[model samples]
Target: MGTLTSILVLSFLIFFHELGHFLAARFFGVHVEVFSIGFGKKVFSKVVGNTQYCLSLIPLGGYVQMKGQDDMDPTKVSYDQDSYNTKAPWKRIIILFAGPFANFLLAFLLFIAVGSMGVNKYAPIIGKISENSPAFEAGIQENDRIVMINGVLIEAWEDVSTHIQESVGKLELKIERAGSVQTLIITPKINEYQNMFGEIKQKKMIGIAPSGKMIEVSYSADKVIGFAYDQTIKATTLILTSLQKLVEGVVSPKELGGIISIVQVTSEASEAGIVALFALTALISVNLGVLNLLPIPALDGGHIMFNAYELITKKAPSERVLTSMTTAGWLLLLSLMALSIFNDIYRLTNGN
Candidate 1:
């Protein structure tokens, strides 16, 4: 059941992505030949208007087949008035960008829904303080709720960490213990810690941990929109940063996971409840959006890059160059997919 739910969620995301391209193409008077929810041999299909909507065998990804705009064969061209090849370069770029933009828009909407449903956050109550640490030396005790730091009112554990990291010299912390409020002055020291990617990094810290207590935070209507926007931007930035770290070797490729890992995590999220499922779905949607914008052949971003060149130079790329680059892009993508699947299997077998 969980696996089925994962497949359905993935399909919905793919459908939404392709719909963006289909709608944009139609808007610009371009003929769409096929709107498929997956790659390879078609298992189900229907002709709707001029477009053939399909459910293909492979559920990994999907595509929009606009007339004269074939990723599989870049050399294919139709210069008819209604064909994609006849569209202006700028228009073509917009058509190419619409797919990823849809994913981001969907993610933003999902985040807003999650916020309305309530977001769980760790309460700013200290669980433990390291021995001889700044917080401990300042007489901070377990179960003491952090009220404010450096005049900034604390709402959650995340706020506490942010204030500590950004503090200049001494931090003025206001805490509530036993229903009584008290103030303490503490100076954070530079400490080395292992981050999420297992990289050692130095940062300012007061050496305090959250008490594992959670609070559900619901935003007002006006604030929910802002919350959604912030969450969407943060998710996008995090994915981009992770990619940068991967390229820089700060994160190992061995940690990469493929469709199997996505399904597993999503399945678990489904079992955890609606809020968890929504949060994971939003994150994955943003991930899809960011990845589809990579400047590689066989992706929306790569096609946009080609179109932008033509827009600037007043000439399209040569057939030979287009075909070669597209082929290389497909090869690179296939190799990465294979590697990620291998890593996923290895982790499962070794119990990582």
Candidate 2:
């Protein structure tokens, strides 16, 4: 049941992402050759109007193939009327940008609804301190309110978490104690522990515990909308930063995950009820949106980059160049996928 639910939720995200491109292409008067809900051999398909819509065997990725997408094939040209290439640069840009934009919009809606329900916040106040731990050595007293870490202002307990997890040893923290603000330096000690995912992680520990507070705060409609928008952007930035670190070899491959990990996480969130599930859904949705926007060939961001170049240089990149880049992108993506799956299998076998 949990696996089925996870698949359904994932399919929903994929459907909306493809729908964004399909709608945008149609709106721009572009002829869509294929609108698929999944990849590989078509399981079910129907030709409607000018488009062949399909649900393929593999439920991974879907695509919107527009006329003149590869090249200005005179043979496939029905009419120049609203062909993708014939559109003005700005229109073309918007159509290409719409897919990711739609993902962002979906994330924003999810966040707004979640926020309106009043998010449970973990206070900055430290509840417990472990003796002989990093926090104790750093003089992080109990009841101290963490204000900032390494000069970055701390909002919720998550802020502290992000800082602590990502930051290297020795970080300066600002805390408010007895109405006086003081600075303390702490080094997060690396501790090998089995994480919730049952994988061993060299977790950074400050040894300070958090206390949660549930408070309903009403915000104006605009604020709710803005909060959603900001959250999506912030989440994207964090994902990108993590990716950069992984690429730079600062993070371990064990941190990477495949479908099994996602299902595990989804099941856990589902067990936490509707609010937690919604929040998790929004997080994953935003992550998907951001990943799709990476400036790699075969992605929307790559297409957008080409369009931008075309607009600036007044000449489209050669089809051969696009094809080569996309092929390479596929190879790189497949390699990463294989690595993640291998990691998953190894962990499972080792009882990680």
Candidate 3:
């Protein structure tokens, strides 16, 4: 039941993503040749008008196949009036960008729903401190409010987390207690924490926790949209920052996980409840949207990059160049996928 539910949820997200491309292409009068919910041989299929709708054996992800869109000529070989290649650069750019935009939109909607119910907001006040931990040894106490970390003003509990993750051995913290502010220096303990998804992460821990507060947030029309947008931006920013850290080796690739990890997360979230499930889905959707926006080949961003070049130079890359670059992109993506899978297997087997 859990496995099926996971697959279904994944399919829904993929469908949501593909729907964007299909709608955008149709809006621009481009013919869609195929809309498939998976890869490999089709288990079931039906043709409607000019489009072939298919459910393939693999349920990992789905895609939109438009007329005149292929590996050789990304715009596809088409002289037809409604061919994708015949579209203006701007239109093509929109079609390429819409898929990720759809995912982002889905995340924003999910966040709005979550916010309407209420959100658990954590105060900067310390609630608990581990014995002999950095915060404890530094004379930090429960009820002390964190004001700053390493000289940066701390506005929320998340700011504390953000600073801690970037810190090395020692950290300087500013705390307010009994109407007096004090600065203390302490070194964090290197520890491993297992996340809700059962992924183990190695982080620098100060052993302080926030005072949890439940805020009944019934937002106004404008506030709801603002909150959703802010949350979406925050999630995207986190992903991008992590990517930067990964490149700098501040984060290890061993922390990475692929489809198997996502399946486990989805199954666990579904078992937990609707809020957990949707929250997980929303986070994943944001990741998908942001990751696709990276200027990597074989992705929507790469297509947009080409369109930009075309608009400037008035000529698309030769078919051979497009095929070669796209093939390289596929190879790079596959390699990364393999690495993520390997990390997942290692972490699971080693009890990480």
Candidate 4:
């Protein structure tokens, strides 16, 4: 049941994302050829007016095929005057931005709805500190409520995890114990940890676990919006911080997850009831939105970059240039996916 739900949830998110592009294109008078919820062989398809809506075999991700805007072979399909390429640059930008924006909006709505119903949260308190660990040496004892990390306010235990994992060497921690606040200087122990997906990641560790006290936070009608926005911003910040760590070599590439990890996580989250599933959905949505905005070919950000350049220089990138960049992008993405799958397999066969 959990596995099935996981698949459905993933498909829903991907479909929602594509629907954004489809709707935006139509609204802006761009001719859309196909609105597909997946790739490869078509499983189900129906023509509605000028667009063919379909569900494809692969459920990993989806696409919106607009006339004359096919990245691979733009000239293959003939476009009407209202085709994507014939539209103004601003219109094209909006069409491209709509996909990621939809994901972010979805996450916001999910958070707001969940927050009003009461969400479980953890405080930033220390429960256990490993002997001889950086945390232990720094005198970060049990019952200490962490107030800050390098001047950033620590509202939850989640913040601690984000800052610690991304740290390269030294760290400043502020904690309150018995109503008295104290500052401590600590350097995380650089080590490798194999995540749930069997990927080995070089990360900084303080060897302190979060306090096990959980609180159910139920917001009032007037406060739910603020709480929701706060949660969304927090999650997004953590993701960006982690990505920065990866790029700076503070973390390893093996830390990244692919389809296997997504399925495993979603399946497990499903067992925790609808609230957990909703939270997972929101997190994934934010991740998708942020990742798609990365300036890499074949991504929304890459397309935006090209459009921006054209707007500035009054010339689009040559077809050959686009082809090369997109090909490289596809290769890079496929390589990462293959690596993530291998990591997942290794974790399942041998205890991670």
Q: Point to the candidate with the largest lDDT.
A: 1
Once fitted onto the true fold, the runs of candidate 1 whose alpha carbons sit more than 4 angstroms away are: none
The lDDT of each candidate is 0.92, 0.79, 0.85, 0.85
**Candidate 1: lDDT of 180?**
92
Tens digits of per-residue lDDT, candidate 1, 207-258, equal 8999999998888899999999999999999999999999999889998889
| Per-residue lDDT of candidate 3, residues 1-352 (tens digit) | 7788889988988898899999999999999999999989999999999899999999998888888877434535887999888899899999989999999999999989877766656767888889988788889998999899898987668778989989876889999999999999988888999864345888889898887843344557778788889889989888888888788877788888998898988999899777778778889999998888877778888888888889889998887778788888888888999999998898789887
How does candidate 3 score on lDDT? Answer: 0.85
Error of 2 at 77 (Å): 8.1
Better model by TM-score, 1 or 2?
1
What number of backbone clashes does candidate 4 have, counting pairs of residues 3 or more apart or in separate chains?
A: 0
Query: Which residue pairs of candidate 1 clash?
Result: none
Please, what are the lDDT tens digits per residue for candidate 2 over residues 1-352? Answer: 7677777777778888878878888887888888888778999999998789899997766777787665322133233775777777777778877887777778888889887876777877787898999899888887889999999988678778889988976889999999999999888887888744344778788888885543344346768887787778888877887887778877788788887777778888888776677778888888888877888776777777777888999997886787777778778778888888888888889888
- Ordered by lDDT, highest first, the candidates read 1, 3, 4, 2
Candidate 4 segments whose C-alpha is farther than 4 A from its true place = 74-79, 123-211
For each candidate, give its TM-score against the true structure.
0.96, 0.73, 0.77, 0.77
Q: In candidate 2, which residue ranges exceed 4 Å CA deviation?
A: 70-79, 129-209, 212-223
